[model samples]
Target chain A: MLGYTLRRILQMIPVLLGATFIIYALTFLMPGDPIAALTGERPLPEATVAQIRQAYHLDDPFFVQYGNYILGVFRGDFGIDFFGRPVLDLILERLPVTFALAVTAWGLKLVIGLVIGVYGGLRAGKAADHFALVFTVLFMGIPGFVIALGGQTYFGVHLGWVDPAGIRAGWPMAFILPALVMALEAAAGLARLTRTSLVDVLRAEYLRTAKAKGLSPQRIIWGHALRNAMIPVVTYLGLSLAGMLGGAVIIEAIFNLPGIGGLMVASINNKEGTVVVGIATLLVLVYLVFNLLVDLTYGLIDPRVRI
Target chain B: MTQLLEVRDLRVQFSTAQGTATAINGVNLSLEHGQSLGILGESGSGKSVTARTIMGLLDMPPAKINGGEILLEGEDLLTATAKRRRQLTGPVMSMVFQDALSALNPVHPVGRQIGELYRVHRGYSRKAAKAAAIEMMDRVRIPAAASRVNDYPHQFSGGMRQRIVIAMALALDPQLLIADEPTTALDVTVQAQILELLKEQQAENNMGLILITHDISVVREVTDQVAVMYAGRIVEQGPTAHVLGDPRHPYTLGLSQSVANEDLKGRRLPAIEGSPPDLLALPRGCSFANRCPLADEQCSSSAPPLESVGAGRTSACFHSGKVASNVAYSN
Candidate 1:
């Protein structure tokens, strides 16, 4: 099992490299120069432009630039942006903000989704199952941006329960609305996945055996059914967490939050390519780490899962 | 001996898209203390349904027990509270499934799964149950029971898994052990070993055994009496020695013929002509008329009740005596 996971971890390197390489390549496709965007329309001398270009290595081949970026990522050295701010340092600072939001949202999503999903699944073919279906559908149907906006509009802006632009202060109460919006959207899909998985698990012969042995429905679900059902849910959660970056972008945009996703957007808009690339690389690493954590979580759940 | 279980006129039905499906119709049987009764039937003959109804495990809406009196030691099991019935499942009665490999929780340890009855019913502490589970595993003759107790269901072989299920069933020493094809999942060699273990356990516990299966040889090996079910009802029932040695119902006779014994090898095996009647679209009266050789206009219009035919035997047939009365049905 150790060997298998070691091989799996080793295999992750190229996949991540390839993904980042493609993303970086796509960034090069975007029009306009970072230095020009930073220091607009003021015509600089060709030599001064060359000096700026050389510093950022615009003269280097795309492959050579990619190689240098990969090496810099390895050494934890993301160079300065056009604004002359340390790209790595800024990203490291902003990362905790995103981490806090994502973690809260993830926690909410997992707890609510699992509880409601397993509940609906156990009460399958009943009113509860129907209700869960409708509820999840309603939540999932709306776009994340819309949910975030509605949350900010009603809960944050009018009622004054929380701030509309999210917490400049790292307070827990500020987390409630944005985290809830993210959670609501995530929970819809996660709940559906959990419900379907749990429903299948409930129908498994082992569950029937448990029932026939006279276990109460609650005991059966919590004891026997939930553990097995959560396997698929775990897989979905891993993928969802990997995709969490994309969601964060929209969420950060909505709440005007300072997170990796928020930083990504700001850097892109301000032509801060180094910070953007650095954040993208970090996102890839987080995705890889999240996947590994999920693997280990699954191993913990099922002892048959060695190591 | 005192009666442990009495199932009378138990009719189970389902109102499907294809009309009403009579999964089990007017099936009657009984078990006395420490005695064994085996029900043999092909698939779809409602053997498992009868067992499920007894356990009250059938999901509502689709499955409804239209009429029945499932008396366990003179108390009506059908009318018993769900809680009471559930209470009795582990304490007074228990069932072992056909596919032992699938019948257990795959993720949990086999010992813990088996020990749940003790934990749930007897209030055995986790540590105590763990120890008891290892002991139970040892009783079932599982090798290295103590160490292997933590192993998952997939870790064990099919026969060993069946033994584990048996261990679970026997853990509480329930009065009745309803083994639904207990050895069906096992090989022939393992099958024999399981049968021996079951018989030994049943005798020691003085538990009434209801071994449900399609194989005549398996029933004959483990059970004292045999009931032959056809088209959701019992056509004949009596002592296994006489019923299997000399079957009364044509279905039972046909079943006995197909047993591939030395005496029947050369004989052109008389297979049942058609599949068991579509329970949803069952004909007006006797469900077996289409396949029964002795069927007439009267036989087609009316279903026969189980009437006393001979010494210790009952056959549900219009012409029970006119046929092979020499085929004795005695225990």
Candidate 2:
């Protein structure tokens, strides 16, 4: 098990490098001189521009500049952004808020999806199954921002449930609307996955034995069927960390929450390459860690999966 | 002897997009305590369906019980409430399946799988259930039951896994145990061992055992009574020795001929001609009429009822007497 984990960690290095390299390369394609954008309207002297370019190694070849950035990332030295503030520090400050939204959304998604999915699976080809099918299709087709905007319009501005936009720190209520919108799409996908997996599991031969043993339908489903069904659901949920992060970008924008996703968009517009690259690197690392955790959990859930 | 189970005119049909197909036709069967009955049939002859319907395990939308009276000790199970049937399942009756590997849950320990009955029905604590499960593993002759109880289904060999299935079935001391081709998925040597285990366990528990198999030799070895099924109906049923020794129906006679004999190896082996009739479009007269060499105009015109042929035997053939005399003369 330890050897497997070590190998996975080793495999993650090249992927991280590739991801950071892509983010670094994308910055160059942003169609503007980042230094001029940083100075913005108050045009700086040519000497000052030269000085700034030299200090940041902007005068070097593209490959050389990327190499320096990679080294700086390894040293935890993400360079200054357009505002001359450390990109790493800025990202770190927003990390907690994004984490809160993501976790809440994910937790809700799993709980709701599993319950509804199991119901649909148990009653496959019946009323509950049809209802779940229609519900999933509707939710999955609609965008999270539409749901967010609708929620804010109805529950926020009209009903005075909370603010129409923006979030307050340490306030659980402020997190509700955005988290719910983010969770809707994820929950729909998970429910569909869960329903399909469980429907298959219910048809397995072991389930026949379970039924023949005189086990209550309830026990048979929860005990034998769900345990086996959970493998695929776990796989989807683990991989969904990346998906939730993407959703959070749209969700954070809609609600005006100060999360890493919101920060990312602002950085993208300003052509702050350091901030974009730094956040992208951190996301890749989070993705790798989540995948590792999922693999380990597979061993715990299913004895057939050897460490 | 007390009747443990009885099925009267039980019919099961599967409704499909094409049409409804009869899986089991007007079948009648009964079992007494401490007796072993073998249901012998080829594939699609409703052997497994009979067992599943008896267990109340068939899903009802695709599968519908058109008509039936499944009685457990004179209690009609078909009309019984779901709760009542469920209550009787583990304690009164249980079933073992054909494929041992698929029958056992791959994720859970074999012992826990066995112990599930005790935990759910008897309300035993987890530790207590584990101990009882180990005892059952020992009873089924699994080596190192104490340690091996924690092992998963894939960890055990085929024969050993079948033994585990038997252990689970016998755990609740059910009055009736249905083994649907229990040894079908095993090797010849392993098949014999699993059969032996089942026979021993049945004898010990004094349970009514219904062993379903296509192998005539398996039925000969393990059962006291035997029923030969042809196209969802029992064509011949009586004592196993009597039925095999003197088959009255052409279908049963045909089945007996297919059993390979070492002495007849150099010659052409006798085989029944034609395939089983299609279930969706069976002839009004008899399903097996086309396949029977002895089938005459009367056989094709109308189906023959299962009639008593004296000596506690029944045969569903109009020329049963003629077939019997000819078979007796040959023997």
Q: What is the Cα-based TM-score of model 2?
A: 0.96
Output the worst ten-in-a-row residue range by lDDT, candidate 1 chain B. Answer: B322-331
* Model 2 regions lying over 4 Å from their true place: A82-84, B324-331
lDDT tens digits, residues A72-104, model 1? 877878777776788888988877777778878
Worst 10 residues of 1 chain A by lDDT: A166-175
Clashes of each: 0, 0
Q: Tell me the tens digit of each residue's lDDT in model 2 across A202-307.
A: 8999999998888888888889999899988988899897667767877888888899989999888877888888888888888889888898888788898866
Q: Comparing chain B with the reference, what is the TM-score for each candidate?
A: 0.95, 0.97
Question: What pairs collide in candidate 2?
Answer: none
For each candidate, report its DockQ versus the true two-chain complex. Answer: 0.74, 0.72
Model 2, position A95, has a per-residue lDDT of: 88
Q: Can you give the lDDT of residue A305 in candidate 2?
A: 89
Superposition error at A224 for model 1 (Å): 1.4
**How well does each candidate superpose onto the true structure, as a TM-score?**
0.96, 0.96
Among incorrect, acceptable, medium and high, the docking class of model 1 is: medium
